[model samples]
Target: MRLLQVVESAATGVGRHVMDLSGGLLERGDEVVLAYADWRMDRMFAEGLARLEPKGLKAIKLPFSREIGPEDLRSIRALRDLIRTHGPFDAVHGHSSKGGAVARVAARTVPRRLYTPHAYITMAPTIGVRKFRLYRALERYLARLGTGTVCVSHHEKAHAVGTLGIPAPTVHVVHNGVAGPARGDRESIRAELGVQEGDVAFGFVGRLWTQKNPLLAVDAFARLRAVHPEARLLMVGTGDLEDAIRARGVPGVELLGERNGPQTMHAFDAFVLPSDYEGFPYVTLEAMATGVPVISTETGAIGEAVRDGVDGFLVPPGDATALSGAMARLMADPALRARMGASARERAGSFTIDGMVEKIRTLYAG
Candidate 1:
């Protein structure tokens, strides 16, 4: 099938998702075109995309700010022109809100237009209620446009129908999948990060933006160290909240910004993601694939992936005390962590990129 994938932010999970998904399709001999705009690490991610496509990647000037505006209209116009010029795409898959808004509107001639919000705008707690209502209204408007939607997890699917007022038939749940690369040199990575041999490292990987709620994790780690001083927190990736994180000055927390996903996973004992909200995080899957038990909040599709008390523990979002307690349990019990780690790896095996591609292919066929 000839496919075009559109995304707004091309740096974090959505970028990784598009890159991996597009490459998988291309490898299967499907013609794939990826269009993106306003990514944090454009040069770095662009290089990765070029290597994946080699043929070329299309560019769309879009940003992840708000509902329809002059810039959004311009993006919609530009993408419409792109679709017209490119002509006759079999499927156009849009990732995240901005891409969904643009591609669905521009897909006048496309056979199948699919949207995955990654997480719907209403999922964001930081936004004002007025804005949330407006965005939901826009979503209701777009819902009538008749493009099928893919929610990243079952939890998110529920939100689409119940909260955002999207028709149930319009949404499908596709849990984010990840297959991590070979383990990195643990000794070397640990040495670089200043993690000692016996340290129970709680790691986090993703943007340090407000949505991620890094402070909760940091506060938890600080409390964790009082009980288990050998505990450490390894943070991978940086974002808008870097200065704020540094200002907090939490001890035993090493801010290792933006290392390789799979390789860096090797240096962690257990993974922690204390995000305020998530659609479904690839970082959690990546950590699980690396055989690291995850301690994440009970939000998004996390409960679907993490079997609480078996593979990992799920605390309430933004609850540092609960997060710290979970870490404390994992940190003090090596045997328990090992058992959970094994289970985590086993759970992650089903979420491979190959599996994701096959399922999406079936969706396209349907």
Candidate 2:
């Protein structure tokens, strides 16, 4: 089957999804073309494309911004032309809002025009009521253009069908999957993060944006520090909240900006993500794949991944006190940490890239 995968902000999790899906399709002898925005491309994603290009992957840079703008008109036309040049794909899959909108409108000729809202904007708690209503309305209309909306999680699917008022039959759920952790020297990774063998290192990896709630992670880490002064927090990735996070001058917190997330997972004893909202982030699954327990907010389909009190603890979003308490629990009990980490790895086995890709491939055929 011939296919086209389109993405605008292909820098983080969404990029990983497209890369894994497209690469899997290619491996199965399917002709795949990836349409991406070079302006928003990161080194990691560019490198991903490089690996696949040699494997018969065709990539076209059709620049598009993250937000809605006048440039979108040009993006839609470019997408239409892409479909023409790569004539008659079996499917055209779009990732995220912008890419989803453009692909749905432009790929009207395609038999399967699928859109995956990695996370709908309306699902954000921080979004004001007016913005929420506006996005909901726009999404409801745009969703109809696609043959189906593939949500990355059940929670996201609920928002699409229930909140956005999209037809239930047209909205589908397909959980994101990981290829397990990258093998690396654990000792070397820990040493790079300044984490000693005795130190309990809590790691956070994601853009330091409002949705990720990096400040909440720092606040929780600070509280844990009062009890365990020797504990360290290793934060990877940079974003809008970088300055704000650094401004607090939180001690024992190493801001190691923008590193390979899976490779860096070896440095962590426990992973922490206090995101206020999510659509099942890959970093969380990568941490589990590395056999590290997680302490994340009960948002998105996180509960579906991390079994609270079994594999890890899930506290309410934005609760520093609860977050800190969970971190403290893991720090004090080495036996518990080991037990939970083992459970995490065992649970993570169910969500594999092979399984996810196979399901999506079936979706394309359906």
* Candidate 2 error regions (>4 Å): none
TM-score for candidate 1, residues paired by index: 0.91
Global CA lDDT of candidate 1, please? 0.81
Clashing pairs in 1: 237-258
* RMSD (Å) per prediction: 2.4, 1.7
Q: CA shift at 192, candidate 2, in angstroms?
A: 3.2
Per-residue lDDT tens digits for candidate 2, residues 1-366, read: 989999998887888889999889888999999999988887779989889999999999996977788889999999999888787889999889999999998899999999998988777777899889888888878877888989888888887877789999988878889888889889998887778769989999888899899999999999889889879999998999999999988888889997787888888889999998878888889999999999999988999899999989999998999999999999899999999999999999989999999999988998
Model 1 misplaced stretches (Cα beyond 4 Å): 38-44, 55-67, 240-250
Superposition error at 91 for model 2 (Å): 1.2
Best TM-score among the predictions, by candidate number:
2
Write candidate 1's Cα lDDT for 100-196 as tens digits: 8788887767878898888787887678989988989988887666468887788888989999888998798777787654668878988887888
